[model samples]
Target: MRIISFQLPVVLSDLDGNRKRFLKAMAEHADDKDVIFMLPEMWGCGFDYKNLQNFAEHTYELISEIQSIINSDTLVITTHPETNQNKVFNTVYAVTKTAVIGKYRKNFLFSPTGEDNYFDKGDDICVVDFKGVRVGFLLCYEIRFPEMFRLTASAGADVVAIPAVWPEAKKDHWQTLTKARAVENQMYVIGCNCSVMHTKKKDMDCGYSVAYDPWGSNLYESVSGEHVLTCEINRENVNDIRQKIPSLSDAMKVFEIKRR
Candidate 1:
């Protein structure tokens, strides 16, 4: 699968501006088939907690517009604020030109930023089969949790997409954890993050949108600013690595034995 990750600068609460920029950037690749395009977490609005509900109202509209632009086989993954009743969740959606295939609401809210106070967590694991490849999801803060990645791997994921707004201060963690997940699971991992956020107080994100192959090798890595990084990954490579290492299966067997 061809993975294209966009490291965009989020305009904080400016939903219209962010929407226009994202759509314009995606328009060029609208016809690109057999590809997965990844955008940063909360691309439409950067954790604009005060007005998140207002932003959530426009989430479907943005998805509709995105669906209208991309090809039928092009899969786009991104996260945004979603509202259901009185609760709001940080939802990641997997979409194609035809329909929304799957969604994973972020379960582990970042308590450092009081994310748990604002958003309700999701319990389901999102693993979707697109074309011939199995795709999985892991939102920003979720990268710190290895069990989530293991669950996706167990569910037969060939590649995992991580949409993040990771801080510049934790750049090393962002890079290390992404690679760890890929190597540990023997699956492709693509992480897309923001360059900077334009809010009342400008916040700089790590912005090192990167991809790692099953062998823990870097497929693509972006610079500190806004940029688009693309790389082609093969599911056969994942299979080869897992077959050679066999750690994933070994660990699963060990867990099964311990359960008895």
Candidate 2:
């Protein structure tokens, strides 16, 4: 399976600007044959921890207009309108050929800043068959939680799609954790991160976006203020790595859960 990741600069909570950035990335990788595209967290709108009701409602129209422009055979990942129980979710949408195939909502909000205060948590994970490959979805902060990937692997995921708007301060953690998850789970990790500075938030973004093999080796990656990191994921290699390492089987041994 071919994977395309976009490390776009945040448009500073401007949906119109952010969607334009996505069009740019799409133009760059549109010719790549059979590739599934991914964008950073809140791709439609940048992180809006405060006044989410105002923020979420504001972007729907812009998103609908942009959604009309997406061409066929290109799978794009981003967030849009999702109606929950008397509420709307900042939910991620996976689209292809003018159809929204699936979605994954942000579950692990940054509790420190009370992001949980704004967005309601999703009750379930999204694991689906991406054409012929078994794939799973994970949001930004969800990368730090191994349990998400564990469930993905257990559910027979060959590739784990991670879309994040991670901060620059945690660059090490972002890179390290992605590799670790791929290595331990014996599944492909496709990480797409934001690259621009956020106006409301003081910190910058970790713009490095890439795809890692099951062996934990980064096959292709990009470091820039903003970029479209597109590369073909050789699905054949996935089986070979798991066969050689056998970590998935090793995980079947035993473990304990500790509630922090």
Candidate 3:
């Protein structure tokens, strides 16, 4: 499967402008088929917590607009603040041209960002089959949790997609955790991050959107800017690595023992 990670500089509180930018990005890859496009968390609103409620109100419309732009074979994955039954969630959706294939609400809210105060946590892990490969969805801060990654990989996910709004200060942590998740799980990891720098505050994003193969090798990585990093992912490499290492198979026995 081919994967494209889009590192976009989203404007805070500028929903219309961001949507236009997203559409423009999609246009570049409109004709491409059998590809997965991964965008950063809150790509439409740039982590503007103050206006999250307003954004959540238009989530359905925004999703529909995005869905209209892509072809049937391309799968777009991104996160937005969603309102469901009067409750809000930081949710990621896997969308095809026809319908939404999967949705995963972020379970581990970033306490430092006060996300826990505004959004409800999700209880379920989401894994979807795209074509023949299984893909898992995870939001920004959840990358810090290995248990979630293990659970998704154990569930037969060949690739894990992470949409993030990570700050520049924690770039090292982001890089380390991304590769660690891929290495430990023996699956491909696709991390898409925002590049918009906050001028009024000290907070800025380091846009090193990256992809790691099953052997923890860097397949594609971008510099600190807006970029579309595209690369082909071979599922055969995943099977080969797991067969050679067999780490996940061993870990399953340990998991069963702990359950008892």
Cα RMSD to the true fold for all candidates = 2.0, 3.1, 1.9
In model 3, what is the error at residue 26, expressed in angstroms? 0.7
User: What's model 3's lDDT at 105?
Assistant: 91
Give every collision pair in model 1: none
Comparing candidate 1 with candidate 2, which one achieves the higher TM-score? 1
Error at 248, model 2, angstroms: 0.6
lDDT values of the candidates?
Answer: 0.87, 0.72, 0.86
- Best-fitting candidate, measured by TM-score? 1
Better of 2 and 3 by TM-score: 3
Shift in Å, residue 18, candidate 3: 0.7
Residue 108's lDDT within candidate 1 is 91
Name the candidate, 1 or 3, with the larger lDDT value: 1
Clashes of each: 0, 0, 0
Candidate 1 versus truth, CA RMSD in Å, comes to 2.0
Instruction: For candidate 2, give the lDDT.
Output: 0.72
Query: How would you encode candidate 2's per-residue C-alpha lDDT over 1-260 as one tens digit per residue?
Result: 57777777776667668777787767766665566778777776665555456666655564455456555656766665455666756687777655667778767877885767667877667776666777788887788899878877876778888888777777788888999999888878988887875676465757877578888788665575766666667667778887887777667556532222
* Model 2 CA deviation exceeding 4 Å by range: 54-67, 201-203, 253-260
lDDT of 3 at 80: 86
| Candidate 1, poorest ten consecutive residues by summed lDDT | 251-260
